[model samples]
Target: MDAPPTEAEVRDRLPAGAAPFAGRRTELAALATAAARTVPGRGRLVVLAGRPGSGRTSLAVQYARSVAADHPDGLLFARMSAPDGSPVPPGRAARRLLEQLDAVPAGLLPADPAAEDPACAALRTALAGRKLLVLLDEVREGAQLLPLLTEEPGCLVLATTAGPLTGIDAIDPVILGGLDQGAAVDLLGELIGGTRISCDPVGAADLAEACTSRPAALRLVAGRLRADARASVTDAAAELAPAVPAAAPQAPKSRGATKPRGRGPAADRRQARELLPAEPVPVADTDPLVAAFGLVYRSLPAPAARMLRMLTLAPTQTADLRTASALVGCPAPEAGTVLEKLAALELLEREPAAADGTERYRVPGRLYPRLVELRSEQDRPAEVELARARLLERLVRLVDSARLLLDRTAGGNPDPLPGPLRLRTPAQAAGWLAEERDQLLDAVRDAIGQGDLDGSAGRLVTALLRALPLTGAAAPADLYQLHELVLRVAERQQAPRRAAAALLNLGDLQAAEGHWPQAEEQYRAALDRARAAGDEPACARALEGTAGCHRALGDPVRAADWYGRALALRQSLGEPRAEARLLVRTAEAHTAQRRFDEAGREYRAAVAVLRRLGEEEAAAALSQALERLRRLVDGEGIVQVSE
Candidate 1:
């Protein structure tokens, strides 16, 4: 499963190492004082609220790390919302938290809805009296934090939100305004060097003011300065001056009042107009952080600039070189250079490189909105849609390529993509699928949501669904949702074959969850769609699903009948593996009906097929079952179903 990043991963995203956090002393002291004053019964909730890029998350992480020893149990972190600004369902959030605490196994699915939330219950029990610190970042609302809150006074809850988390009880909010000038300059000094700031203290102060004392804005300015060693603070400030709002024009003298100035108001107004930028900047454009973003954006070369605009359409939260390359229709080497340049400019945050040495980058949460706005303002609708289409097509081919390499049942070699994307081995293929699981899900959403009713979206989603087991990346509920999404897309496209495949996938999930009736309903629906499409393989799959559901529901006769039909279909299709699997199912159904002789015959047939297919392990297992069945029949002993 793609669990939330561990504490170490979260720390990597924080402003640590070379980019030291230089401000928030008062806030840290406040948190420390609060910890010192903790009462016995109830816990303390300190919410760090601020605008995007105001350093709320960084401060929280810094404070948590400083006091790690105080919470010997653990310091856990959970993002209350996804990077795409969607609130994570509380149940899912609870599961992630519990996994972090090692209270539940990773990738464990939730209990049945009819039962209580075992995940949340287990979390509460596990955290009942521990001296733990929970950092909840990107919290969207007060209610979103409730499920994750604990009542122990020994525990400390530090939550970060874009705005005030109102209506929560006993809440202590540390609203993070812009940094003080000294602190902002200190941050600049840290980025560059104190010697540079000492040389032109006035310019450093002016630059801080121009950046509105926002840490993120300062970082951008500092990044630019560091990249060009000869660039001074004054130079950076002047470059950003156009984005800063000019002082409001003095009100015109009243009609009755006489002008006593040396130069008339008209001349002054004309001169001021000439001094202003040719293009009018919006109110939001006046924001220092936004201005800094614009400054960095305008400095980009044409290809990098266009790639920045199209990056908002990237389905993944963090993009690797392949995704970046596909977004701009560029080669991998060119895309890598562009990505590194953006990272240097602080336009994107560079994540640790993947094990395969693929460079990854993300549009910082605070910067993403501005990037999206730029896409809307600079790129035409057609251009944006083309980028979106290219990205989706790239994702489809990559996923299909990975699936082909992983699942032998998925016949045919992957085509279209060049050598780099053709995942060579099963391990490599599965790892790629797992790493990009969420991105794949988001791509499916994008594919369908973009009004592609021509079955392309369904095909993309189906490709991912077929590879779900090999990846084992998604939780059962998430997989179920994706299947439903694919089903809807298939139905809208009037693609019966795709719809049947989606239905069978849904049926398998339901059966795994022990919902026999629901599983049967999905299987029956799939059977109808398969018949309508005259898709024999899909029909066989649906038959197999229905047979399993019937067997689960204790209808052995129906199970045996359906299994026989599915087995016949597989045999006719020359699918030896599928035939062997159905034979085993048929043997189980016969054993359930107390037909020991028939069960032994079916087991023997399955063993022969397994051995012919070089499946030694399966053949040996089935051979043992066949011998056991013979002994049971000869001695008139009890017939037990195979494990």
Candidate 2:
């Protein structure tokens, strides 16, 4: 019997990392149960269906992990896409599956990539006998994946997607409604703080209702208020009062026929409905979330309402009075006044900032998500596009400005980042990003989702990744999600240039996080894309990155292959300084693999390069390598050098 892929192996199988989403226990359970029928000779394909922010992708991932122990073969996940609204060919998804199975695919191998049938054949054949877990995340519909479903035993198929997979009636299908009342509250409790919930029962209850019990809504709301030390639960609840109602989705039309009424949890719902009302209320009459936001939007002064719509112009924490005013074509003072009103209404919060006079505001706790949802509802595609262009225009400028500041600073600067743009130190940069990083990322994501296909995501992602390394205060989950988002955005655009850069950055994160094989894959993918795009500089960077990954994996020979490429690329680009630095790194790899002669020559070359560049620090770095190589030749060894 062939060995099954381990959890580590299955994880590394993913081309890009996974984004972390909260609250989808019900959806996940449905997928797991559907997939549980896989036997030695018989298997089933289970489709997870939901709309945007419905938590389908998250559920499929969770189910795959939960059942990993039972099906040792491994898990393969893919996001399928095609031209127009046509289903992606099964062959394309199959190739992705094979790639995840540790099979180094030749290239983008899709013949009739618009057809699901042919694509599924390749995947079905690949799964002949070995146990495998396949997750088709975020597809157009179930029929697109129908061909990929295998009859072979020992294989589990998990298909998570947006909307009802109408044609998949023959198979098990579970529609994810909004989270239940109890679970939604529990999730909010976990995110917001048990103490706060306990102290202000009404506030907590109100917040839960305002969030519509949607996991994403609840988490978003909880995360916002958690930062306000002075925030009372009731105050926060009141802020989200428009969104406040109840946790559960309004009953399904079918369920309404059979289900009882007036048995819902009764608590301080009015206060909970304050924050967000952007997400569509599918059960408008029955859902408290709809009631909450409906009231908020209705009550707003027309100027404020118009301004609220215009806020699609602002990035999460970067929204200052000036930007708001400029975007809305109003004066700064006018915008400031409106901003305070939004805050008073619990629609925004001004975070504590340094001495810089610039102040920053976020959508009141989780209510901001509604703004995004609301933005998407414009009936006219032209209007939506127009709004997107305006928003991204402002974002492009903001990120460009931020990038200038990032480039000027080396490690530390005492003057401080001006205003609410608080990146004082590397650590502070990381902490600030970690704290508000999700909101920022969500803003960027909204930009892409609404089709901001220009190089805008590239710059925004650059700012994000640059900020990531410095933040030690963020959760691992948040860090990884950022990585996942960057990868997704780059890939979706099919812009290999951007993809390669994001891959290198993501590999750095993975390597740092102890995911070496995965890091190596990212590095290799980056190297391939860079070379293909004829981006010599990026190629060299990727090569160097791959070498570092190899060194971490204790594979000096492979490390040498990558480093040698980096050195050649640097040399070709006329960067003698960079060439020398890589040479020195190559020498260290040699020492690690116990190759003394080669190590010695590499060190000498590095020293020569450092002297030419007048890099005293780098020249000093070679001393330890010199000593180590000499010691190795004399039956001694190398010493660790500080960076």
Question: Which candidate wins on lDDT?
Answer: 1
After superposition, candidate 2 runs with Cα above 4 Å error = 1-301, 308-329, 339-381, 395-436, 464-487, 565-575, 582-643
Model 2 TM-score, all chains together = 0.45
Clashing pairs in 1: none
Q: Over 4 Å off in model 1, which ranges?
A: 1-18, 34-45, 70-76, 82-84, 91-133, 150-157, 228-231, 235-279, 282-285, 400-430, 453-463, 466-468, 471-474, 527-643
Q: What is the C-alpha RMSD of each candidate to the true structure, in Å?
A: 8.3, 15.2
Model 2 clash tally, residue pairs: 32
Which candidate leads the pack in TM-score? 1
Q: Among all windows of ten consecutive residues in candidate 1, which has the lowest summed lDDT?
A: 266-275
lDDT of 1 by residue, 16-101 (tens): 32257886778788777766655344567777888886878778888988876667677877667765687866676676666566
Clashes of each: 0, 32
What is candidate 2's lDDT per residue for 1-643, written digit by digit as tens?
Answer: 8776666655423222122344555566666677666434346777777654445555666677767766666777765642122455455467556655655322222222243433356567778786777877667775667677778777777776666677654665788866665555556667666787777655565555555555544544454465456766666555554333345444222222221233233343333332234444333243443344454565677778767766755654346664576556666678878887775544554554423444566544234455655655632556545555654555445444443444556543333322433334443433444444544665666666655544565566666655554443333434555666777776787778877877887677677666677778888898888877788898888888888878888899988888998899899899997888788888878877877777788888788788878887878878776975575566654443222
Model 2: lowest-lDDT 10 consecutive positions: 251-260
Cand. 1 Cα-lDDT: 0.74
lDDT of each: 0.74, 0.60
